[model samples]
Target: MPRNDDLLDNPRSPRVRAVAKLAKRDARSETGLFLLEGPQAVSEALTYRPELVLELFATPTAIERYDTIEQLADEAGIDVEFVTEAVLSTMADTVTPQGLVAVCRQFPTSVKEIFAAADGEGPKLIAILEEVRDPGNAGTIIRAADAAGADAVIMTGRSVDLYNPKVVRATTGSLFHVPVAVGIELPAIIARCREAGVQVLAADVKGDDLLAARQGGLLDAATAWLFGNEARGLTDENLARADAAVVVPIYGHAESMNLATAASVCLYESAFAHRA
Candidate 1:
């Protein structure tokens, strides 16, 4: 059992106020920490690297539902804070709070780490998102990547903050299962992928190749796929940089698939190809 404190009960506490505001981009950037909410995400964090957790907060009721969380906290030597429902609501992004939230240190791995992990006989599969504005979409894509067993997810340009509360929730705790890198330059990332012998395939609405048809052969040759934003899709510059472009075939009258859906389709195709 860990000691529980109600220090956050003081709304005027400068430290509490500062961390609350750090949920925003500027503060996250300045401090290199992000806020995670709900028991699942916090549980994943504890599993991935307990040392990354800075603090844990829970409503009395929340601790009951997620008893394992308290055990993890005890084993990891993390401080737990008990806060009122009103205070939790203020900090929670969801309407129905799961009764827990955590402040975590950012785990920003370098490009070198990504490459070093891929050194083996088999090909490497990586997912890159360019300027993906929606945190939900980004988080879903990260979850999809994990499902497909991709190496890592790379976020470039002004994509949604990986630590965004919604994104963290959307990941359903897979955010900690996989490695994520953000704020990278697209062109530079392209060069790095090429140097590492990872073929870059960009997903586009008007792509020349159909995702289903190119399945076993196409993906077996490459190492990774690039997914773009929902609204505009991949920019011409990024598309041109890809070794090839792939599109998920749509027979229905639907205009296009959601960004996350499209990425999932592509990732599954790659996984299938590798399995074959």
Candidate 2:
């Protein structure tokens, strides 16, 4: 239960400033915590990983509108602290916090745990992000990976910070749904995938046509799709490390597809083949 009497109304309070500081990478790195903005992200955190949520803040109206969040929070033994709209906004990274926000621990899965093939239960399909600095693209790829039933996502050391607020928001609620391993070097990840018997397939424009791979029965194997930066794609050295390189064919007169769109197509291709 929350105490309305103790409503946080100060937008300039020390606590509010501390929470707002989480928007910066240094603060998040030091505190091992990140900000969860909007009702959707907060609700997902409460539902999927309540233990990681250090604090929950919401406007009285927000709790009323999203009463299920309150119920879930209560069930998880989390006490919601009612805050004024101004206070909520001060603690949020987005322009509009949607009247709810949360402080959650950053839980990054180790690459070894992700590639753990003990008992022959390793991941069949995985997504690896290399030097993917665009927060939106990285997040969407993670969402697409989850939607395609991929086992996990691994972001190379050169990629954007996994705890970036923009990345978290772009994920919607899928950030909570997928296991993401961050900060691992690309070469090490590829080696681990090889040991796990997962073929690393680099998604690059210079690669073999995706249709050819599908026709060759390559998509049905335990595979890890490597996606690179939005602008540059994969470097030649990195591409050479892959078991194979694949390109999603562009059938239309359109110049090019967005990285996330191309990634979804590639991931779903494997998903379809796995089930077929």
Candidate 3:
């Protein structure tokens, strides 16, 4: 058991108050950092092994429930602070507070860095999301991409911020496992993929190709999957740029699948083809 300090007792401390207020977009933008609340999210952050964790707060009740986390934090030399329930609730996003939260520095990544990290081999499996406005969907896609062993995740146009608390929570810590490049120009990225011999496949409801059966025959050559926004789907420009359009067959009279579900289906299909 780690000792609880005075810092935890003062919920209105300048830093603690700042973290509480900084949950807003404007404050996060100003600081280039975001707040992560809940035990699950904080546990995932530990896996990332962040170089600088500003603070760690846990309610006594939370420490009792998550003994493993407490032990891990002690081993990692992380200081644990005990806060009042009211304080914890103020910092939490949910009606029921999980009793753990942490503030961490943001690490920005770029396309050049990703290419360099790949040792010039180029990404064999990439997922490109164009203007996905929902943070939950975006985070889920990233988590799926990581699970499918994708080389990278590219966000184009005006997509949701990857570091949004909702997105971070959705990723469940897969955010650290994957390389994400945001605000990329779609057309230019497509051209770069073509130059690298990566086949660009777009996911479209009206696509002529079926995703699963095409394995080892048509889609075997594709190296990347492109997904678009939920409401409008892919734009004409994106569709025109794709080497091929792939669609998942839906039955039982559903209008369409959710964006995150559609992306997961397509990514898994590509993974299957690669294995085949």
Task: Output the better candidate (2/3) by TM-score.
Answer: 2
Candidate 2: segments with Cα more than 4 A from true spot: 1-5
Candidate 1: stretches off by over 4 Å: 1-8, 117-123, 211-216
Give per-residue CA lDDT, model 2, range 77-106, as digits (tens).
Answer: 999889998998889888866888899998
> What Cα-based lDDT does every candidate model obtain?
0.82, 0.91, 0.79
**How well does model 2 score by local distance difference test?**
0.91
TM-score of each: 0.92, 0.97, 0.90
Query: Model 3: number of clashes?
Result: 0
Candidate that scores best on lDDT = 2
Estimate, for each residue in 1-276, the C-alpha lDDT of model 3 and write its tens digit: 445554356667776788787667787778877777777777777756645466788888888998777777776788778787778877766678688888777765687765553554777788998888898999999999999988889888578887788887888778777888887899878887887788988888768656454743666664778888889988887898998888888877998789999888888877877787
* Leading candidate by TM-score: 2
How many residue pairs clash in each candidate at the backbone level?
0, 0, 0
lDDT of 1 at 255: 79
lDDT of 1: 0.82
Local error of candidate 3 at residue 164 (angstroms): 1.2
After TM-score superposition, the amount by which residue 267's alpha carbon in candidate 2 deviates from its true location, in angstroms, is: 0.9
